[model samples]
Target: MKHREYGVVQRVDHHGRTAIVNWYRTYTSTDEPVPQLLYESEMSVYDLKDHPDFQYRPGTVVIRVANFTGEDANCTAGQ
Candidate 1:
């Protein structure tokens, strides 16, 4: 599986166990369009303090999306 690191947590849906994340627009690549939101079930969120990037705020968190190749990313969360 491949991993794609997303940006700061804009908002979280506690009921759905999901989150809305936003990427740093300045740093995005041209090869592919990065989604502005990702699900927590398909990703792992970590405090921005642990990230090496200086763009994000300290109190915010970043998400690393779980990419399962041809399969669904959300399928590997709890199982």
Candidate 2:
């Protein structure tokens, strides 16, 4: 997984859990791709496709997906 990348969901956990996610078709957005933190994890890999907000792992290729914007780049804790 690269930092601040845009790509499609390559795989998902069969156990219905968030495991290691891989992105193949990747792209880089000149503008920051914003994601609604509240709804970030709300959608699954299947839901990401055709979704206005292309959600995925940290820093995955999101392309033109419409998402929320925040000043905080690091969504993780203790950053």
| Model 1 backbone overlap count | 0
lDDT agreement of model 2 with the native: 0.42
After TM-score superposition, what is the CA distance of residue 29 in candidate 1 from its true location, in Å? 15
Cα lDDT tens digits, model 2, 1-79, are 2343434444558677443334332334636553212112223545443324454556666343333347544344434
Model 2 residue 63 lDDT? 45
Candidate 2 regions exceeding 4 Å error are 1-5, 17-43, 51-79
- Please give the RMSD to the true structure for each candidate, in Å: 14.6, 11.9
Question: What is the per-residue lDDT of model 1 for residues 1-79, given as tens digits with 9 covering 90 to 100?
Answer: 1134546666766666665655544325544544534333323344333445446655667565543444564565545
Question: What lDDT would each prediction earn against the true structure?
Answer: 0.49, 0.42
Clashing pairs in 2: 5-60, 5-61, 6-61, 6-62, 7-61, 36-68
Clash pairs, model 1 backbone: none
Give per-residue lDDT, candidate 1, residue 52.
51
